[model samples]
Target: MSTGPGILAPVTALGAATLRLLGEMGAMFLFLADGLRLIFASPKQIPKILNQVFVIGSKSLFVILLIGVFTGMVLGLQGYYTLVKFGSEGLLGAAVALSLIRELGPVLTAIMVTGRAGSSMAAEIGVMRITDQIDALDVMDINPMAYLVSPRIAASLISFPLLTAVFDVVGILGGYVTGVTLLGINEGVYFYRIQTSVEMADITGGFMKSLLFAVIVATVSCYQGYFTHMRRDGVGPEGVSNSTTSAVVLSCVFVLVADYALTSFLL
Candidate 1:
């Protein structure tokens, strides 16, 4: 009898949600532009940027190594068995190297760093917002965006590529250990295939993905934290927690989505 109102209710909710998402996305892009624009506003920012690099890059090194090795080993094991069916186990090296360098290296590095550093960014900024520390910086004309967000953005840009390189190298070695040393595949063939099959284009494409992911993770993480106080779902400590959770989740989702988009273009 009242189907009109029922249907309209769901439609209105969906429309409102879509509008809100679009608004938030617009705001986030502006936030990223502003943060990047102010990255070099002062020479004194050098130390801050370096500090963030250490935080986001050096600190995450061990986890990246551990994950990279295991992933490569798994790839080697699987690729060997799969290729052996066709008597092409020698291609294992090429398969693992290409997979890690062109895809997994950038994607996994970004996701891991996002988990470690992105969440921290959101939590730290969210805490600052809730505690009025950000306000104090504004009162002092310190430019909170420049002071807090820009360094992080700069650091992510620096860190993501380097970490991806490390992941690729370590993953290749791991694959070597499994495919050649343990699996008894020809070491020369393994390395030769990797060298011959992987091109400069693939390497550059992976770096490009890392750079884009760096921007996405940094901007989304900082934006979530900066606007924590404005969240409708929570406030104060709860708001900080929600912001941190949202930052990690959104960064990962954005990373994967960006990865697919980049792959399509690069391929």
Candidate 2:
């Protein structure tokens, strides 16, 4: 039999969880705003921002290529088979192009960067926090957010869209190879239909989504690192690892949720 306290325990737990979630959300909002402000404050951190952009954006190119190629090839192969069943295999080019430009390209590129650059950002910051490096900055009277966090956030915002564009181009090329060379589709029809079907709206909308996703990823990653605590009195390696995992998972979930919401509203 359930006692009164026992019954109340579940409700209490739920309330606590909800409060915690709201609190975290509020804190994260403030943190993100602070980071953004720090980005454009005096001295601009231009050098660091550019370096982070290169590291975060350029370093992920090979991984993007590998995934983008395979994803496009698979989309081509599967889309062709499905369309062929209705003798509309002629639409393969349009379908693949639409899929990449309108949705897959930006979403997958952000997810890939989340896994690669996002995790790295969290881990790097986590290590600094655990090692007392952040404290050292504070001791020197330096604002850590300006020096440490702002550049990363700005870099992500810039890198994600650029990387997504490359992913789109490469993905289209892969689809071309699969649909035309491998599947023996009519090449001229493919290009012509895609050129006609895909519009500027689709490309621009996807880029907008990528920009929003970048903010989510960078904010979550920086938050995880900046707040993660060590076991003894501060953070340890295990804490860093856990924070990194949390950042990546949360960023991915937020990306998907945002993607759905944006697609519904925009498309």
Candidate 3:
């Protein structure tokens, strides 16, 4: 007859698991619906979308450039040493180009964006949630999802590819400098090798991955922030903090997973 504790334990565990799964599913559906709406309602918000794209894409150029340069330099230095041991120093350009275009560019850019812009987006939305601004938008007959979330998703879609291209170009320049100037590789030979080695497939693969990463980052950040309960009786500062942390961690994990999946399928 004293089965109260055992029964209560299982019931509580099930209830908690159910609630967590429901919350995650709800957030995912909201994000999907938001993305679909943006895709269908495109022409109306072109200007706003463009503004966001510019802000998201252009504002990130400096950091991407810096990372690209360093990445290229390091690649060249490392590749050169490795190839020299095998008398294959001429493959330096191809090595750098392949590495940058295939892996490092997308992954590094995503990590940086997730850490910088993603965190910012989550924090900003968290603040709005806590302040009831999102609710006020609903009361004013404005679709908060359309107004707040769509622009970001659109901006990310447009910005990520551009950022990837920038990363590619800057990284190549970095490799060129280190290889030609420091390693004494002939400039013409280095450029020619890169031109021949890198193909459209590599470029396309990187861009596709970047686009997916952008979507993942934007969606995760928005979801975390939007679902964050800041009410007095619900999620408070601690919850918001957890949301922000989870957003970054989840975005990173998805980026890496997506990268591998895309690479496998594409290549």
Candidate 4:
């Protein structure tokens, strides 16, 4: 018996969607590869990379510090109460430190950067794409990937770890404020537990996650913006808007997924 058109239509659509997803993934991989290849091809890119570091890193500092501190404070409060129930309040430092250094610090930092700088990267590139500025670069014999994408990628590689370190340090201080200053946990005990419980491995793992998140955010944002002109959802300004939204959403999702995978491996 032959299948009806009704049955075939859904299958066809599903197939098309799958193919499109695969194609996009392939294109993204190539885009990242090309960008990475160009990142160190010329010494002149150092200035551009430094500029992006400022854009993606320095511009993001205040927000990261704010979030990190609040996150640590919350963790300290909750952990203190929870540990108190078990007569283990002294371990609060270890708990807070481990959580921040191993997970929250890197993850939150990445998400924040995605929300701030990732959106900017997408919108800027999408605008350029829509306005034919990318084409203008081509006509000028400039490598758009180098001139536009690589510096951002290189900057991300440098900036993420630094930002994550800042987040971790600030967060730890926040925890200390809540646990020691507010909750009456012994100050010496807090620092002692942290020093004893946190190892180099934990710090390294967090940095690794931050680095991975940086690449994910940069690549996804750039790829979406770079191809905004080809989006089926919209075009021109609307396309840029859609691309920016998608860039932030995808970057966050990928960060979480990568975190899980990395955590499993690191564990």
lDDT of each: 0.96, 0.91, 0.85, 0.96
Candidate 3 Cα misplacement greater than 4 A, ranges: 1-26, 42-44, 230-234
Model 3, 111-154: lDDT tens digits are 88788788877877887887799999999987778877888888
Reference-based lDDT, residue 239, model 4: 99
All candidates: TM-score: 0.98, 0.96, 0.88, 0.98
Q: Which regions in candidate 1 have their CA more than 4 angstroms from the true location?
A: 1-3
lDDT of 2: 0.91
- lDDT score of residue 61 within candidate 3: 84
lDDT (0-100) at residue 83 of candidate 3?
Answer: 92
For residues 69-157, could you state the per-residue lDDT of candidate 1 as single tens digits?
99999999999999999999989999999999999999999999999999999999999999999999999989999999999999999
Compared with the true structure, what per-residue lDDT tens digits does model 2 show for residues 1-267?
Answer: 657887788899999999989999999999999999999987769999999998899999999999998888998999999999999998988898889988999899999999999999999999999889999999999999999899999999999999898888888888889999999998999899899999999999989998999999999999999887732333598889889999999999999999999999996
lDDT of 3 at 193: 85
| Candidate 3 clash pair list | none
Candidate 1 vs candidate 2, TM-score winner? 1
Tens-place lDDT per residue, model 4, 1-267, is 987999889889999999998998899989999999999899999999999999999999999999999999999999999999999999999999999999999999999999999999999999999999999999999999999999999999999999999999999999999999998999999999999999999999999999899899999999999999999999999999999999999999989999999999999
Residue pairs with clashing backbones, model 1: none
Kindly report which residue stretches of model 4 are placed more than 4 angstroms away from their true locations once superposed: none
Better of 1 and 4 by lDDT: 1
CA RMSD for every model? 1.1, 2.0, 3.3, 0.9
Best-fitting candidate, measured by lDDT? 1
